[model samples]
Target: MKVKDKVVIVTGAGSGIGNAIAKHFAYHGAKVIVSDINLEKAKKVSEEIVTNFGESLPIKADVANYEEVKNLIQHAVTAYGQLDVLVNNAGVGPKQMAKTAEYTLEDWDDVIAVNQTGVFYGMQLALQQMTQQGFGNIVNIASLAGLKASLNNISYTASKFAVVGMTKSAALEYAKTGIRINAVCPGYTESALLDQLLATRPDMDARLKRIIPMQRYGEASEIAEAVVWLASDSTKFITGQTITLDGGTSL
Candidate 1:
C-alpha cells in the first residue's frame, strides 16, 4: 500500500481517528492536507507532521457546510495540482444517547448534519475533482453502528448507516470512472469520542469490551492502517465494501 507522493486530504484531522489517519498517511510519504473545523488543532497536527519530515497543510473547514467543503477541495488542488485521495473522516456522535422514542429532533438533526451530510459534501466535491483527474480514492470513516443497531444511540446509528449506503452507491457509480469509494467501520475504538461516552457512564467501558469477541477495544492507529491501505493502489480491485475493524463486535 504505497501512498508516497500522493496528495491526500483528511477531514476532521484535528484529533482522534482523523488525526491518526493524517499522521499515518504523512508517515507513508503522502502529502496530507489536515483539515478540521478547529484551525488551531489542524495547524498543530500539520506542524507535527512537518516536524517529522512529512509534507502537510492545515486547513480549517466545517465539513457540514457546503461552501467550506468546496473551498477545502480547491485549496488542496491548488497546492498539490491534483487530488489523489480524500478521506471523509469528519464525523460527530450524538450529544446525548437516547432511544428512538426518547430522541429529540434537535439531536437527530445535529448528528446527521455532521456525520452524514458532511460526508456527502466531501464525497460530492471530491468526485468532481477526481473525475477531472481521471483517478482518485475516498475512504470514509464509518462505525460498527452503521452495520448494526447501537441500542440507545439512534441518531449516530442512522447517520453511519447512511454513510455505508452512500459508500456503496457512489462506489458503483464511479467504479469504472477510476475513482474508488469505500468505508471503514470501527467498533468502540479508543478515541476522544469514546472517552466522552465512557465518562458519561463509567461502567460502559467494561460492558462494551465484553461484547467484542476479542474482549478489547480497537485502536485508532489500527483503523488508520486499514484506511491507508484502502486508499492505496494495493486495493485497486476493492470498492463499495465496508471493512469492519471492530474486534469481532459485529460477529
Candidate 2:
C-alpha cells in the first residue's frame, strides 16, 4: 500500500513501457495521469483505466517541449490536488535512422531533445512541486545503453548516460528535502520499437537473445514493476542509484 491513493504522472503512456506502468499503478489504486504525445492514444488509455475502475487523467504532451511539460504538470496538480510520483519515461531512439557515421545534426538533435532534455525538464518541474510538498518520488527511465558502448547510435547512449548522472546528482541534493530520485536501466524489452526492429531484421533475433544472460527479452511489465517498487515507500532509502533490469547483459 505504499503508493495507494497517490497521484502519479507517467509520460509516454500511450504505448510500450509507459502504458504498462500507467496501467499497473492504476491497478494498485493510484490515481495515474496517463500522458503521451499522441492525444487520441492518451485518451484511449485513460478510458481503459476508467473501464478497469481506476482514476486517470489523460494528457497530450510532448515532453521534448518545455511549455507542454509545464502545462502537463499543472494539469496534474489542478486535477489531483497533490503530486506524489513522477515517472519521466518519455523517450526516443535512433531506431528511426541507423546511420551513425552518416547521421545528421537533425537526427542527433531529435533523439537528445526527447530522451535527454525532456527528462531534465520533467525532473525539474516534478522536483519543484515535490519540494514544496516536502515528499515525492521521481523515477527516470534510463537504459542499459547508458552503461554500455552503443555502436550504431552514439547520441542515444550519451543522452541516457546524462540521464543516469542527473538522477544520482539530483537524488543527492533532494533526498534530505524529501524527494527521492532513481533510474531503471532496461535492456531490450518487448516494446513497440523492439517489435519494429524484429520485423525489419527477422534474422538477428536469435543473436540478440544470446547477448543477454536471460534467453528471452524483458517485458514492459518487468520494467513497470521496478518503477513501481522505486515509486513506493519500500524504496525509501534507495535514492541516487539505478537498478538495471537487463538480465545480466552488463555482467
Candidate 3:
C-alpha cells in the first residue's frame, strides 16, 4: 500500500514493462491511468484493472506530441482531481536501422521523437501540475544502454542517456520542493522489444546469460517494483539518481 490512493499516470501502459507497471500500481491501491498510443490495448489493461477491483482509466496518447501529452495530464487531473505520480515509459525503436551511418534520418527521428522528446513532454506537463501542487514524483524509464552503450542501437542509447541526464537535472532543480524525479535503467528484460531484438540475433539468449552475470533476463515486474518504490513516499529522500536493474550487466 505504498502508493495507496495516489493518482498515477503511466504512459505506454498497453503492454510490456509499461503494462506491468500500470498493474503493479493498481495492485498497490493507486489510481492508475493506463495510457498508450493504441486505444484498444489501453482499454484492455484498464478493464483488467477495473475487473480486479482497482481504480484505473484508459486513455490514448502519443507522447511524441506535446499537445497530446499536455492533454493527457489534464485529463488525468480531471478524472482524479490531483496528480501524484508519472511514469514516462512510452518509447520506440528502429527495426533494422541500428547502424549509425546506414540508418535513415526518418528512423532516427522516429526513435528520438518517442524516446527522448516524449519524456520531455511528459516531464514538462507533469512538472507544471506537480510544481503547482508542491508535491509529485516522476519515474522515467531509461535503459542500461544509457549507462553503457549498445552497438548499432545508437538512437535508443543516446535517447536513454538524455533521459538519465534530465532526471538528474530535474531532480536537482526541484530538490527544495516536495517533488522527486528519477530514472530506472533496466537491462535486457522480458518484453516484446526483447523478443524483437532476439529475433535479429540467434545467440542473444546465450550471449546475455554469459555477460549478464545473473544468467537470466530481468522480468518486467522486477522493473515495475523498483519504479513503485521510487514513486512511494518511503523513498522520498532518494532522488536525482538512476537506479540500474540490469542483473549485474553493468558490473
Give a tens-digit lDDT track for model 1, residues 132-223: 99999999999999999887899899899999999999999999999999999999999988987898786988888889899988999999
Candidate 2 CA-lDDT value: 0.90
Residue range with the least summed lDDT across 10 consecutive positions in model 3: 95-104
Q: What is the C-alpha lDDT of each candidate?
A: 0.94, 0.90, 0.93
Worst 10 residues of 1 by lDDT: 193-202
Residues 181-246 of candidate 2 have per-residue lDDT tens digits of 999999989997677667656676997888989888999999999999899988888999999999
Instruction: Give every collision pair in model 1.
Output: none
The TM-score of predicted model 3 comes to 0.98
Candidate 1 TM-score over all chains jointly: 0.98
The C-alpha stretches of model 1 lying farther than 4 A from their native spots are none
By descending TM-score, how would the candidates be arranged?
Answer: 1, 3, 2
Local accuracy of candidate 3 as per-residue lDDT tens digits, 174-231 = 9999999999999999998898888887897787789988889999999999999999
Candidate 3's C-alpha runs over 4 A off are none
